[model samples]
Target chain A: MHNQIFEKYTKADKSSLIPLLQEVQAIYGYLPEDALTDVSEYVKLPLSRVYGVATFYNQFRMSPLGENVIRVCRGTACHVKNSSNLLFALEDALNIKAGETTRDKKFTIELVNCIGACSIAPVITVNDDYFGRITTKDIPSIVKKYAGKTKTNGVTVTEEAV
Target chain B: MVELTINKIKVKAEDNMTILDAAKSVGITVPTLCHLKDLVPSGACRICSVEVEGFRNLVPSCAYPVSEGLVVETNSPRVRRARKTIVELLVEDHPQDCLVCVRNKNCELQDLAERYSLREHRFHGESKEHSIDISSASMERDPGKCILCGRCVRVCNEVQKIGAIDFTNRGFKSIVTTPYDKGLNVSDCILCVQCIVVCPTAALRERSSMKEVSSALESRTKFAVAQIAPAVRATLGEEYHLPLGTDVTGKLVTGLKRLGFKKVFDTNFAADLTIWEEANELIHRLVNNEPVPMFTSCCPGWVKFLEHNYPDLIQHLSSCKSPHEMEGAVLKTYYAKKLGISPKDVFVVSIMPCTVKKFEASRPELTEEKLQDVDAVLTTRELVRFFNVAGIDFADLNDSEFDNPLGESTGAAAIFGTSGGVMEAALRTAYFTLTGENLETMELNAVRGTDGVKETIIKIGDKELHVAVVNGIGNVREILDQVREGRSHYQFVEVMACPGGCINGGGQPIHQKTDKVLQRMRALYEIDKKMLKRRSHENESIKTLYKEFFIEPGSHVSHEILHTHYHSRKK
Candidate 1:
């Protein structure tokens, strides 16, 4: 999809390549290696310098994203609510820690500070949707919903996991 | 000067001055804690927040750049609200023990609480409870009262260049501590106490010597002699509301006498003695083709720094003990014998402008006949407290002289209180001793002043003497790095752990702004410039002592009594 977009965008001035690459990354959720070559060819910037800028800022993601992205609120409000324990539980259930995607690419977890909603603290956002009043015990079943599975305990995995 | 307006009052300020400075020039007082003049402005404490006409939100006046036609409201409702909110937030987590804290009456936070009428805390939560670490011989650390102002971090890293302590964690849980929360005694901490001086709260304090001094005085079994450091004379008057740089030597002597000290001596005399030994040692090193750069050992902080971080360079350190401790050792030995009193009967006390001197006095090596060289160490501030306790009005006390031979000193001895002064003093003696000719100019101007790191080369006779002077630990790191890289240009380096030397030491009276401290430092240099006997060897008493007793400088007898060794600290 990025290659197709890059090929279509290359008709314009080469300087527009950075914006195009950023847009592609934003859509695809990570900057692929082929995208860097495409960016260097289209923008006329050194590949190393472009890669340097990409790595310098924490905002840019380099690897592929998991099917489900779990962002645990580690903000002061949530932290006081034992969000660190909730974070540990989520990491265990997903079989991957924060900032890492699972081996099967099924789930990824990230810790973030206040998303500005402190009322329902110890909160987790699954794929850009909020899940409030989350407990450590709720982590395993919640993660199973993203993998399209159900448990023997009759805990129904909601279709809309968020 | 750039013209600026604050709250409708126009003021002229130097170009590049901050709005806070401009406001201050116009007699407007802005509350601040982390801003020290000599130190780089760390906009950590938002107490100095002010409203600017064009800016949307309140900005820290301490760091905000002043501009032409700029309008600043120092105490507008919005500014007050922001300042109050910041102060309240800081107070929320702050330990509520101001009445019992060491800095109860003198703390910046306590003053702010009084200024803002903060009787009760609106926000309450679990406060940080860090166990107080008093393991370091020189200073104590109380993390519970830390405001996270970063003054100590800035002074240590940016000014001293030591980077011994830094902000370890993040946000509310963040703390200033050595890497891995290691005790300071075990870390590469120099025991400079520069951190103690800059800390706004009781988070850092010098270990007290008041009890020991009081006990000794009360006993009356021992003959107590109190020696005042050279720097103390320059700034001790400030605590009594005397003007900056007012000479308080006579009053200091009188106060010590009133405090039950049998004899009041001068540390300047020992400083002159230090010059004689250190200069002779430096020349000896040059002649023997030994370690080219002989480090000045007068600063305990610098001595500890070399012990911990640069133990390999220990051989380069001049073997002379600091004038304060050197006097203590001599008083217990030589003075004891002269007065026909047993060493046990003589209690040697030092009133210094440094907290590290307390640590230096505690070192087991500086002992004679199983008694410590210095029985008690009192900071300049502590001495002032003693004066107040004794009801001795410093201003009312008539000018008097220090007791006998130990009381006399040269101008070179006086400047030992400031950074680079020891190097300059040593050079004045060393150059004359080597060439056997009086120096045309006594002041070694190149090595003077308060630059963090300064270097100069002088052609003395046949040798081109390469020298470096560093005031703060941060500067020491850069110089040490150069030496480690085998590219150092200096043949001799003098390092003082405080930014402006002893005058601005960790034990000195705390100034709210860095500018005021710099002003005081400048006043000290001015006092140095006006002194009659500007060279250490030129002092009559020092010459007589050398001729009659020690025989010559750096002799075996002098070295045994005056010089010492360094130890490597496990990091």
Candidate 2:
């Protein structure tokens, strides 16, 4: 099923693994287990070694991402300004924990070290659009915006618990 | 060779050799943890820190290479303090219930603490929390006792190549666990329990069935019967401070009898029966061109591995039940019927030198009408504990013989403890059955040894058979790859999950050296040398068993009672 994804790197040696995984992840947004298995077979390395290497680097994600990706900044500036609480609030609003996608694949929450925007403390980026100085109270509406629902327009809000 | 100075002694070592290896060459005892002799060095544990002349910080002796003219101090004051602090911290984070731990006095951390003359825990009152994972039938995982040494992880990944467990999460919460922290049962674990053997602490342990066995023996309604595997006899003596290769078959029988077991049988008898059935099946396969390589199904770990990973190749597995399970089935059926008792009243317990036997006994297919064939499996280590708990002096116990009927076995059965033994035994029987005569010399020396994989072509009469023996579980990959790629067509193949087979089984006494396994192999060969009947077909008792109970080798009745099937597993 994933032959086309790994067709180019089928005969590649050990050194081509990371680039191949990157290419596959770029297409799928995350490293699926089946693709990793195919990569392991293609590179002739044990699945554990492939997985161990993939985990050592912070760039690789093991699970597929949801349609809407949310990156919550846990930088030193954000933490001091109660961004951790904002993260929890987003987790509740999206009904998904950090590093986990929602059951309906509508939203995903991730906690990253820094986004290089300390001036906008407690920032949460919904996709490419950044929401700066995000408060716990702002999590629901921000999640609803990507959930394709508007409370003022009388569109039903998504509150599915994982 | 690189010239280096270890503790003021000039030593010449390899260029890429680690400081620990260099020190050992010159008789310097540099302590090491998480440093397995083979495979890759994961120098995660910092207990092997050594002081160097130029380096500002103490270097982990296990990971650091011995450079030219490198001066290393293995036991300097700073190194001692650092090592002590590292061990103290490991102990502080670990549970303090050493008095009742399964590893107890045998743990590596406990040994270090004692060697350092640790009077009291210098650092105290740490959060001792862990979820004890006993989900696996063969083993247990105690996260509290784990010091994050990564020995088990390396063994599982590198040596066995199973990769059932790995270092999950990061930093403080880092643990050696199955993917997504799932129980080992649901994972791709073959239940080999090789990780348990490499573990320095009590983090990985056998899922002991001793309590259930004790309770079964105490039951007034049931008559408890015990069977000891061939490998258990070869290594059980080591637990009592006896020599590694000392064969305690007789003494083990006496100890079992003393412990109140009504009937004491040998799994060797069942091993003979397995050969009898498996050899005929091989002959059938060879003649009919069924599965090219009829793989032995004795090792449950290997069987599970094939079922989970190479699910398509399950056809190569022999239909014959493992030795102990076969014996357990006969004990509940033939033995019980002959004694005029219900199968339920005959409680079967197997003393195995394998942790996978515990899982094998629990396999639903091995049961008969909701009644398990083997009620309990006590590993060789658990048997030693049982012996101690019963106050039986195993070292001085008088030798005793096994009971009648199901107790008799041949030399071929005795050698089933070591690698390539099943092949040798089956070859002896198959050659005899096909040619109607035994080979001039009963021993087939070509397939015998500690090699990872041994391949040979033996001529019976007009037909030549391609045979191979694989010791380690990881070593089977090449041969299986050959099979998958249509490269080689082996008529018969033997596989053992443990490196040296059941003698060095995961459930055997803990010993680091591989040479000890060789000693046990020699012991098994000695048993073969002494026995008058060296082939499975020569056992009169087995012949009688077939004549009275099953009627024929591949009879439908025999298949019903002694045969089983395998299914592909979800990882």
Candidate 3:
């Protein structure tokens, strides 16, 4: 599947590079190990520097992404509202600590500071959407929403248990 | 001349003129607090910040010079916001006692606050609370009210030539104080009171003489006589909304008359008398070879400067009280005898243009028979306040002359108000008295005008006389420094604490940002130019007084009354 995506990505148009790279990372869950080198040479940057730039930013990843990104706000207002407890719950339920993708690659959890909707805090963001007044108990269902979703062609598939 | 555009308006200004001056030349008003005309511009206050097109930050327009083709904005939104923020920050920690402050209505900071429409402090923070230090008998220092503008420090160091006070510490902890926070009276301070005059806030103020004068006025039993200093006439008009350097001598006499004084005597008469005694003493010193260099004693600031800083040179200073003090002493004794009144019942009040005169008048050494020479010394500002209280319209008052005997003065007496004036006045009498030949020109143009220290060599008969004139105390320091190094070539020197001399003394009427000290000094010289008799020796009144009363200059009676001694002070 990785080879197939690499071949198709090589033939892909240069004008669509940013979006295609983003799309490929979205489909496969993250930029694959070889994608950076291939993209670097295609764009004429040294592979090492490109990898360095990719790793420097928190937004980029070399491994496949989980099915969902769960961001818990630890902003001043949210931190006071027990957001830490919700982060712990999500960490325990996923069986992987905060900042790590789940074993089944279904969810990735992270904490952010003050996302500006501080008025509705104890807030969490799943991808682009925000969930306010979140509790520890809501972690399972939040992860379950993207667990059984169909995988697109040239995308990674990983098995999940319960 | 350099042409510069300020706020899109092009203006021509002389070379070496600052952008603020250029802006002012073209009627572009920029507010400032620490910029005084006679003193060096320290630019401590950032209120005059203006936007120069290429500069990274707002620059102080008062200190920044204009360059060709430079575009400047005086009142742009950015400049206004920066100025407002700077003022707000200053006001945040500033004492909020404008109504009760001594400079209440006259304060530049308060006026700026009104101009900026600052109704509230947006950035209130911890204010440094300092106790009032009134250790000096002459002036009071309220650190609680100091804006830390360094005008006092500059005036003390640069203008007065005395470095008694300086900015100690750094940043927010900085303060203007004597060394080791010692009281001014304990420091090598000369008690010039020039600091009090230049201070923007009420931080430094002259000790109050209002109550003393008020009580004197209320006590109808004593016969009160007021003497006006020559400089007072040159600057007193400013108190009555008169222009800078307005010669309101006639009106000032009228106002004093309206203030209910029994007689308004002219200190100029005594100024002429001072020249006679001082010149005679200088000639005597030169002839007897007693103290080769004789310093003029007409300026109390210079006398105090000698006592405090150059104590070793005290002998070099002529033992003469200032004209004001001399007039005060004479008023109580000679005038009292003439009127057949007891000296105890005669009140001698002097209206002077110097705050230091207040300190001078109260000097222990100036007392005669345990009675103070001058009972009260009112600055020109205080006299104006007195006039206002008495509802006297100085401008509308009918022109009147000072009373006889003591009222008549020569042009030499008139020029005493300006820098180098006393020296010129003295020279006119001294050269003639020594050679018995009249001076070719009454105007001694070389010693006249507003240079910091003017040195000249004149051919007095067969002798080449060396003379140095130091107007501001700041200039005095340089000359003294040279003297201390044994490099002083001057046989005679005249030093006035204030720049441009007593006409610009600290006790003179306050010049609201627009008028400056140098302008007032020039106005004094102009008045001197218009006078008929510019030579002190030529004044008929002075000659008559010499023959009738004192017998001669430096006579035993004159020495007992007019000459004074000074003491060395500890730091």
Candidate 4:
């Protein structure tokens, strides 16, 4: 399955590593350890080096992605606008820290540099839906909105998050 | 040619040379922390930062290219301040237990601090707490002492071509580690300790067997017997401040005896025995038209490297235990039986120049009846430390001979320390086996060199044997790939994981000069040249052993006692 993603890249062509990783990430939602090993073999780079590259970049994650990715922008504008409080509020609601998924895998709190909407200052994006200028009080209700349901195979599945 | 002015002294150097090399041409020594000789400059640690007249910022001389009419000041006020500050900052976070550190005086970071007169840690706040990884039986990782020089990384990735560790994370959180920050034992590490060789500080070191050996020596019921590898003799002299290439064989035996070993043997004896088994195995493969290329199985690191990476070609490896393992096996079985002592009571200690030998000693595959072939292994460095702690002055030591039977070895065994020595040794015996006589000239100059790979052909009887000698583990990949692809032309291949073989093994005394390794290589050849018995087949002791116990080479009993198989370590 991972071989299809490596079809465009030449064997031992290290320049294609990032794109290949991106493709793998795109399909798998995150970089799998076995896929990374395959990539290491395909690119003729050591697994340690591939892993180093993966861990260095914030975009690539080692674990499987949760049902919903809650990206909290910690950029200069968002940080100055007290975005940390919003993040702490989200963490309190989800009971999971940034760069970690909830026990039920319902939501993943990711501390991103920017969401590219600085006009709002503090911003939190759950999936494609943006919650701009949100305060600590708004976190629990926003989380609860996506807390009960999940999407399975691109269809809205009405079921408990667990 | 590029002209560069270093400290106002104009000098002409090669156009491709870096500013560091250009400065060195004029006798201006620019100190560097991350510059490894012959490897790509990492410039990770900017200790070699120097002032260039036109540049706004100080350039790292190690990575900076030397250009025409470039003006450089190696030790200007600005450069000195920068270098001092770099040293001071590194020392600030580094462990302050240098007095009790493994590389106290030998550490490059410690030397840099001393050179810059860093009497105090100027910068202090939060120091990163890193737990030492002692999971590997051979190598240790002390992240607290690591200066992030990346020398070990380069040696592992570029030299050995085994990237078991790399620069992970980013910035202050950066560390050279295995994938997922896993311990080296679980990682794809071959336990070669080549990384330990290049590491500037105590961040990397061999897992010492000193305590085990000490206790074993003091055991009332146990008979502690020490066997010294051929390579250890050539390099061990460096610890005593002896001149390069000095063979400390006789004194080494004396030291081992002084260390309370009941008997001190020579691993060279088993090295000859390795040839006895390996040469015959090669002939067996050749006669039967089995695998064409039979790789030498002496270097434990090389064996593990093959097992890890080239598992498909495991059949090409000779079914022979490494020399030290063979010595340990024979000592436990044949020698113990001869001495009327139980194998359980015999505590075998191997003094090897290679760190991987420690891991090899602990291997379950190499054991018989749950008894590890060797009980303990101490590298030359560890043995040096052991001697120091025991207050034995090396310089004042007298010459002594190794104990009989297993101690006696031919001159061919002495050269087993170097890269091509095994192949050369095997050829001598193989020739003798094929044709009922030995070659006129013993030295196969084609295989002898410091080159990463050496290819040659030799005529034995009616057959022409094609052989290749790989000095470094990095160079073996291309050769093995050919073999895997069925494009390999050679019938015999010898690989020593450490560049230039066990003489420059990771466990040898550390020195900045590469020439010391060459000198040690020369010393092994000298030992081979001086000995009366030059061929493994000519060893009277080996002949007696064959007659009394093993019967003949490649015998079922010999296979059971001396030979072992390789298995795939790849997941």
Candidate 5:
């Protein structure tokens, strides 16, 4: 918990809560639980209120970011194509719940609403690459590809797989 | 005053008043679920939606300001339809098991449902499955039953200033929960249970010890003993539909006896003992120039609050356990020895006005030789349930006397039920301890009433003592900030977590009636006035206890049995 970000605002200035939290999240990638306590003291707001505000907004995240972000669309079009099964399979394979980063920060899984690609229907995206009409069997191979990537490795494959 | 016509009746109300207040002034009942008096109205429930003459949509009477010439129909056909639909929607997501709920007939939501004549289950929505949180020793939370009225959240944040729980997530997924959605025991919750008092549904309640107590009473090996707190006497009558502030001490004793308790003792006896020890402790501190502004440790909620928020100031809180805990300790030790029974075999059940006492009883520090002083705690409301379960006629019961020795108490102990009671009671004894003379005026009017914070200056001989009494925990911050900055001038301070003290505690009868706390305060003072001994030092039983076992006030033995230490609960 560095005091550098906190130096931007006066102590107990409640109006600075959202901006302070955004700054903290930007520096840490996600709002760390320990840092939230420090943020509470800095803003003179209760920790529960701080945590409440953090959880209310979709912009802020509580857990650390993984090297690769996996988004599973649970939109109406994807629902009819059994996209939930793919989500479950990914959760089992990665051993992490949706909206949680893996312990090693290798992969983070999130359940998103509409990604506006109904033609791709049951879609699961890894980084910027999209997998269309994927099934449960495809989850293991998708996870394997991401798990092999190093921290500095960049995704060059932009082709959408079906 | 702003003139408004409510339900075709002309009413004059203050310009700043809301539509709800204007209607209320004309005796027109406009029902509200989310509107809490004295707090900022959120208008979340919209149960008080009223038809205004010019408004396109029905405005919430609770939040809508009253203006001149405003025509408001509190129960118009459209307003009724909207209110019914809101109730239907609320009940659709709520559980249908009202028969087994803790609130049952006493529930405000149930009353609203009946008032709206909601006979049909109009709407069916997918209910959110929430696991009941019973991790805390004091209270339980069932989010499944919550209507999101924000009453509990408002009271927790606004009144107590302890935001242990808040609305988390967004839209339909929102819930009032602790930080990280963790158990309250692990969170910064002080187990005050103020949230329980404000909750309209069975969403929040005191954790029951009735079963534990019943089983203990049935056990032949266990000698069940009951101790009733000062506040319980003044407030418990409300459950039996008796007059408000009726001191049912005698009836309470008789009822406890009928429930199979071997002896019924008064927590007031220990309250006197607390004063004896606390006054001496204050004098010691004042003379030696020790920590000034020594806080009263009687309210477990306040003690836990200080421990969590101001761990560095724990030294300033008196080490004395609360009155009931003190009585329980004495019962398990001196009384048990007198009866030739082991402390573990003597099961002490405390009947208190506080929900926090349930948590306080479970503290390891309040135990000796691995045996907790109080086995279980039953709140005033729980005691009502106990009586109902036993089929005991509470109002008709013959008035009986409290068992001797531990049952005896002075008038100083009786006033411990209200705010400033402890300070007044302690000052009475402390004045005597310092100057060997009782206060000329027994009533400390400065400390009395429903004010959040009270301050008084007393001149005792050559010594002028300054003191402050804080009722609501939220109001203590200003004084505490001063103390932290070394600007506090008071020699003594008292803080109770609940506003207006134990008389309006979370465990007392839940009602929206005004002046109930004031009536209870008056009744406690009346009890003090009628007592034979007005000072704690004048109690003969306390004197006997001191002579027989504890030796004297602030003795090593007294310190060991009666006093307890606090640790920081910061996370």
Candidate 6:
């Protein structure tokens, strides 16, 4: 599985570590520790450096992926409209805090800085579908939508989604 | 040349130099929190900020390169307020328990707090809470005191090339830690504690054995004995405000004896014993043509590094125990039996100049009948503390002598603390053992500096031995690669995990403002030159020791006590 990732970057080297990490994250949803170790050895960088660069940017995740990646926007508009309350309701309903995946691998919650969509204040995104203008009452049903639904490649797939 | 005015003083410096270096050249000292010499300047800590005439904001002096005509004010009211605010903030997040802290009066952060006249925290609240990491046998990690200066992180990656720790997590929650915050023993850490050497705060420090030493001394049933390493004599005087490399060998012996040690011995005797045994082993390998390039295994850090990084090359390491390990075994078995005591009754303590010696002393492989060879290991810095706590006036004490039977050693044994000292000492004995003759001139000057790598060739008899001496563990990678590629022809190699040898070991005093490692190296050579006998084989005590105890240097009985085997760690 790691060799396939290495084969794409014959022209790219250590300078392309960020893009390579993005590509790996696209394939694996999150960076695996074993894969990062292999990348560290493959790129001739220390494991600490690999982890350092990976952690520097917010796009990469070290934790395992859940079926539904819930991004609750904490942007100025979202926070002003009480997105934190919505986040708390989501955490309470799913029993998993932000930056955590549920034990069933059904839902993962994330609190992000911004999503650049203030037209609909308090946006909560699950996979590619956006549930803007969200409320605390909207969390249970939204979490139940991802429940018991079989995902493509362990994720709800969309043509335009990452 | 770059000319600039720093605090109304005209200074001329190089064009590419940072403002910090430029100010340093003129002796106008600027306080730096994160600037470690020889590391890539991490301007993360903005404590060294200075005001420029045209700039609206203060610039970090450590990362800012000086222009030809830049006007800078380093000590204006605005600059002082900014620096004081930074110090206050750092102090606010730090635990104010300096009175009970390990680095109490000697901490860099404490010094800055005094220099800035910081009375109390202005915005003090919510200090980061962290549990102390005492998982490493040789060192400890207290993240609460860490200011995120990145000195320990850089040193672990850059100088040592062992990336066991780095900045993890993000933002205010960021910490310098191992992978998954695992214990350092489980990480690729060799327990060398080089990271502790560069740490400005008590965030990283040696896993102290003072409590263990104190308990052993207070025990009435056990007999407490001590052995001091060669490097300890050269560097211990620095803690007493003596000039670096002041040879206080007599003072060390006097202090240990005064502090209730029943017997005081020298580790150099075992160093000589190591030479006698290691030389024989080298000859055995040469004659049989097995393990062509024999690696010296005197340094425990380097030995563990080899076992972790290159397990296949474990065969190259000589099986002889390190100098202190050999001394500890002999103290428990030979010396204990001679004194009509059980090995269990003999509490052997070693004062070492290396942190890894603490971990090395606890190795199960070095034990006999489940009894630890050395009971406790103390660093040179710890000995200095022990002296102060015991009220022993170390400097004023009269010169003392080492105990008999295992106290005698030659000049070759004294030089074992320096980088190339081991190779030179081993060659001297191996030459004598093979050809039944010593070299006319004993000083191998070619291999005796603080360089990262030193290569030389010396004719022992008919064979011209190609030898390489590696000062740091990072330098061993290339040489090991060369040997593995079958492209190198060196017969013997000496690897010291620290930049200099044991004189600059991680267990020494911190932040002495001089290149004392060089001075210590010269002091060891001076001690060797003044001695009547210069070779390890000429140590009469070792000769009598072999005849009385083991009958031969490499006999079955000697191998059981004095030698060790290596195994692969899951790296």
Leading candidate by DockQ: 5
> With candidate 6 superimposed using the best TM-score fit, by how many Å does residue B323's alpha carbon deviate from the native?
0.5
lDDT of 3 at B269: 91
Better structure of 3 and 6 per lDDT = 6
lDDT of model 4, residue B345: 92
**Judged by DockQ cut-offs, is candidate 1 incorrect, acceptable, medium or high?**
incorrect
lDDT of 4: 0.89
Taking the tens digit of each residue's C-alpha lDDT, what string does model 5 give over A63-153?
A: 7889999989999999999999988999999999999998998999988898888887788888877788777878888889879985444
Clashing pairs in 6: none
Task: Quote the lDDT for B290 in model 2.
Answer: 92
Candidate 4: residue A102 Cα off by (Å) = 1.8
- Candidate 1 vs candidate 6: the TM-score winner is 6
Clashing pairs in 5: none
Residues B1-571, candidate 6, lDDT per residue (tens digit)?
9799998889898988999999888887889978877677889899999998899999999999988988888889999999999888888999889999889888889999999998755794777878888987899999999999998888888888988889987888888888767778788888888777778889999999999889889999889999999999998888888887889999888999989999999999999999999999988998999886899999999998998889989999999999999999998888888889989989999999989999898889989779988889999989988999999988788889899877899999999999999999999999998889888788998889988999998787678989999998878899999888998889999999998889889998887465777898998999999999999999999988898898898899999999999999845
Give lDDT tens digits, candidate 2, residues B1-571.
Answer: 9898888999999888999988988788877788888677778888999999999999998888889999999888899999888888888898888998889878899999987777777887646466888899999998878888888888777878888788765666567777556687887788888888888889999998988999999999889999999988888888888877998889999999999999999899999999999999999988898978889999999999898878888998999999999999998888889999999988999999899999999999998767899999999899889988888889999999999888999999999999999999999999989999887877888888888898888898988999999998989988888887888778899999988899888898985765788899999999989999899999999999998999988899889889999999944
Model 5: per-residue lDDT, tens digit, B463-516?
799999998898998998899999999989999999899998988999888889
DockQ of candidate 4 compared with the true complex: 0.80
Predictions ranked by lDDT, top down?
5, 4, 6, 2, 1, 3
DockQ of 2: 0.25
Q: How far in Å is the alpha carbon of B238 misplaced in model 1?
A: 0.4
> Model 5 segments beyond 4 Å from truth?
A72-105, A111-124, A130-147, A151-162
lDDT of 1 by residue, B84-131 (tens): 777888888888777677787888887787888887778877888898
The worst-scoring run of ten residues by lDDT in candidate 2 chain B lies at B173-182
Better of 2 and 5 by DockQ: 5
TM-score of 6: 0.95
Distance from true position, residue A126, model 5, in Å? 2.4
